[model samples]
Target chain A: MLKVLKYSFYDLSRSRWTYAYLLFFLLLTFGLLNFSHDLSKTIISLMNVVLILTPLIGTLFGALYYYNSKEFIDLLLALPLPRRSIFLGKYLGLSLSLSASFVIGILAPMLLFGILSTGLVLNLVILMSTGVLLTFIFTAIAFLVSIRFEHPIRGFGAAIFIWLFLAVIYDGILLLILIWFEHYPLDHFALLMTLFNPVDLSRVLIMLQLDISALMGYTGAVFRKFLGTSLGMSIAYATLLTWIIVPVFAFLWLARRKDF
Target chain B: MIVRDLYKSYRKHQVLKGVSLGLDPGRITAVLGPNGSGKTTLIKCMLGMVIGQQGEISANGKNIGHDYLYRKDIGYLPQIARFPENLKVRELVSMVKDLRNQPANYEELVSRFGLGPFMQKPLRNLSGGTRQKVNILLAFMFDSRYYILDEPTAGLDPLSLQRFKEMLLNEKQKGKAVLMTTHMVHLAEEMADEVVFLLEGKVYFHGGVQELKDTYDGMNLEAAIANILSLQEHA
Candidate 1:
């Protein structure tokens, strides 16, 4: 698996898209910092972009990489390596590269603005970790969709739709549900719905960490009441970790039975 | 290597039905059939690329269903030479060697195919024929005991084709088993010591080149195969 991972990382290291992704984050971070010297405000602004953009790029890049590497995967399948190794290696290689870009793209600008000397370093850390987690979760889901659907267009379309549903539509539907159940105590329902979507879960987690739950209205105050404790925070992180684990195992199972 | 009573299907369409054959060392067996006749399916089943719904494939007397290490002895050349874009030929070759963790001497094969100039070129930059040459080189680079090539000569020029044929013959002389599928019947006529004719998921004929010809009134290999297909269509 490590051997395959090394080669995969090497293969993707030259990808122009990865560099483009990194450069986009750099420019965004630098631009945001230039506009606001207030460190907390910049972190919150960066959080919004990371929540939407990381998952989007992860989905698109993951699907594109899988389709493009179909031939390479066939070649690897014929070799002595196990199917688990080839697939998981590719997934990790992609996720790690994207995570590296996200980290560097954010960190370079944060360091330049003298973030280390301030109290907001931990906030930036939380923001970057959320970005990395989103990368892994969305990439794994994209890989699963691509593996299940053989045609490139269908797989790419399905992946993009998933990102759309999770990042945008899921919130809209949640809003409708909240309005429909306006008379009842609905904090638990709202929390459960947030847990179902990694994107929303990440947003709540970041907003809570930034100490801006008051700005989130009633749902924010409810989120702070439930997720303010250390125990609740641990559970949220565990849920995010589960999001990464489930899709990875599902793809590995599919890869084993699939015919090249 | 032996494949016994193999059966495979995609959805409701059965591709291979109860096909059986054995590969002997130091001989070349050409798997021939019309389009969609399970030639590639059978090859994939044996290599465990496509799992058979019902069958047993054994390498050196061990069942290969749950074992991947058995593939270490077989070198496979797929139908098309698909490679990662932006990867140089030299890097691809080295990557395979690194993955296999075995001593491989690809220098001689590269020189024989005259791919020295394209060593530093990215795989996508090479023409189809050059890519095919690279595919052939990768399949023959390691000294494996068995070679399974699917359409091994698809896009080669005459000179590279000749070199490829010579290299295959050299491997056969070294007591390696070579199983290949090809549409070029004349090339099969020249190189195959035996032939396995698959017609509609079954082996219609499995015998020597001359025996197949003699059975069909001494016609050439291509016409003999065509005759089998025509007879099947009539029946």
Candidate 2:
């Protein structure tokens, strides 16, 4: 398993695509911070760009990697290593690489932006968490998709469709749903939906923390109540963890059953 | 090994229909057939890489798909010779040995295959023939008991092909079971102990290579195959 993980990272490091992504994010944050010295401005800018972009790109790129590396995966399978170990090894490796980028990429910019204050610390923590959460969540999703789709283009198409639905269309549909249920008490239901969708929840939590939850529409306050308290935040964290785990186990199940 | 009434279909098109065959050690077998004749499918069934509709494949005194220990001693080189892009030749060789549950001098394997000159090169950077050489080396490096090499000499040069044949014969000397598929009749004519001719998802013939050659009078092995296939087609 350690061998698998080590080789997985080694393979990942060889790709100029991954290197480009890391540099793009790092430079984007660095340049954005220079544009604004205010800590909140920097945090929001980073959050908006990373939250909307990283998951889809990460999921697509990760899925692409899985498909393109079929030869390697088959080689791994040919060895005496258990399917679970190989699958988990690659998953852990991908997580670490993306997580390192998320942490270090944002940290460098935060330090240079003169972030030596309490608010800066909070903003940095929040920003870093969002990046890792995005990476892990999409990695889980990507792993499952990659195992399921044998064709690389098809997997990419499916990933984009899924990202579009989760990131955009789902929100529109939920808005109409909330409007239809305006006469009834749907705050709990609204909170449940937010928990189910981590992307919306992450953005909503950050907005509420910045004391601007009202702009998130009526569903924001309901989510704030469920995600604002210490316990609420912990529950939100657990939900994010579930987002990462559900797909992880699903991918493992598929990997084990996959003929490759 | 035993495959009892095996069946496999891709969506609505049935590729394998109630095919059954038995295999044993110390014999070199050839799955000879044209394209889409289900020869590869049969190999996949034996490896449990493809799930059949209704069948049980057993190998080495244990039921196939249920006994992984049987596979622990098997070395498989897939139909296509592919490796992880950007992997050094030595790294790929080392990875296979590691998976085979042992460690060996990977550089030795590389040097033996004349891959030392390209040792640090990436897989994608290598030529098709070189990649095929790498695949062959990895399959035979660990000294497996059961070897399934698909089109093993597809891109090999004459000298390398001769070396590979010698290597296969060495495995035969160890009493290992080798099931190889090939389009080159000459290699099969030279290396195989048994010829299992596959046609339209079924085993039309399974016997020693001499038995196949001597089946039809006054015809060479290739001519005999053409005659037998034409007869099958007409029948």
Candidate 3:
């Protein structure tokens, strides 16, 4: 498994797309810092971009890599290795590389700005951790979709739709539900809905951490009431971790029984 | 190696129906069939690439479903030669070696296939024949008890084809079980001591080449196979 992971990582590290992704982060972080000149404000701006962009890239890159390497994977399946190792290795390799890019891309700019020496360091850590978690979650979902669909076009389309539904549509529907139930005490319903979507949960977590929950409207205020303490934060992080674990296990289950 | 009561289907279409055969060392058995007759599917099931719905395949006294380590005893050449385009030929070779953790002397196979010049080139840069040669080299590099070659003669020049035949003969001489599938009847005639003919996911015939010829009342191996298919059409 480690050997497979090593080769996958080596292969991805040399690809032009990895470098392009890294460069995009660098330019975005540097541009945001230069324009805002405020650490918290810059983090807020970065959060908005990270929430949407990371999942999009993760979904597309994951599916593309799986489809492109499929023949080679068939070759590997003939080798003296377990199917679980082959698949999990590729998933870990991709996740690590993407996480490395996110970390280095944002860290380099933050260090240059001396943000580490200020009270905003915790916020920076939360923001980066959220980005990493999103990468893992979306990439695993992509792998699950790719393994289930044999055709690249179908797999690609399904993955993109998942990202769209989670990142955008889920929020719109949640808004409608909130307005429709405006007559009742809906904090619990809003919290449960946020928990269902990682994107919304991440936004609430970050906003609460930045101590700007007052601007977050009704649901955000409710999230603050529930997640204002460290225990709530821990629960949110646990839920995010569940988001990563479920899809990955589902991918492995499907891959084990799949025919090449 | 033995495969017993093998059955496989893709959705509503059955590809292999109760294929049972025993493969022996020091012999080459050619699996022959028309398109969609399940030749490759049988080989894939044996290799455990495609799981059979109901069957048992055992290699060297161990059931394949028991563990994957048994795959080390079998070397396979796929029908298509596709690889990671970004990896150089040498790197790909070494990576396979690293994965299998087996000592392999690919140097001779490389030189025999005239792949010395392309060793440093990425796989995508090589021609189809060269890639096929590379595939041949990889399959032949490691010494194993069983060799499964699917369409092994595809895209090969006459000279390289000759070399491939010699390689198979050498393996047979060393007492290795070689199972191959091909449309090249002449190659099968020259190399296969026995042939298994498949039609509509069932074994239509399995015997020595001469036996197949005599049974079908044909002049040669190709005629015998054609006769069998034509007979099926009439029936």
**Per-residue C-alpha lDDT of model 2 across residues A1-260, encoded as one tens digit per residue:** 78888888877776776677778878988888777767777777777887788787768877877877677777766566677878889888887787776677778777877787545677677767877888888877888887898888888888777778878888898889989988998888888887778788777767767777887666677777677789999988888899988999998988766655
Docking quality band of candidate 1, CAPRI definitions: high
Interface RMSD of 3: 0.9
Candidate closest to the true structure, highest DockQ:
3
Task: For model 3, state the Cα shift of residue B126 in Å.
Answer: 1.4
lDDT against the true structure, per candidate, is 0.92, 0.77, 0.91
TM-score of chain B of each: 0.98, 0.91, 0.98
Model 1: per-residue lDDT, tens digit, B1-235?
9999999999999999999998999999999888899999898888888989998999999999857898889889989788876789999999999888778999999899999999999898999999998998888899899999999999888988888888899999999999999889998899999988888899988999999999989899889888877888898
- What's the ranking of the predictions by TM-score, best on top? 3, 1, 2
lDDT tens readout by residue for model 1, A147-190:
99999999999999999999999999999988998999888899
Q: What is the lDDT of residue A74 in candidate 2?
A: 70
- Position B32, candidate 1: lDDT: 87
Every candidate's DockQ is 0.82, 0.44, 0.83
**iRMS (Å) per candidate:** 0.8, 2.3, 0.9
Clash pairs for candidate 1: none
- TM-score per prediction, in order, is 0.97, 0.90, 0.98
**Tens digits of lDDT, candidate 3, B15-96:** 9999998889999999999999999899989888899999899999888983689889988999988888888999999999
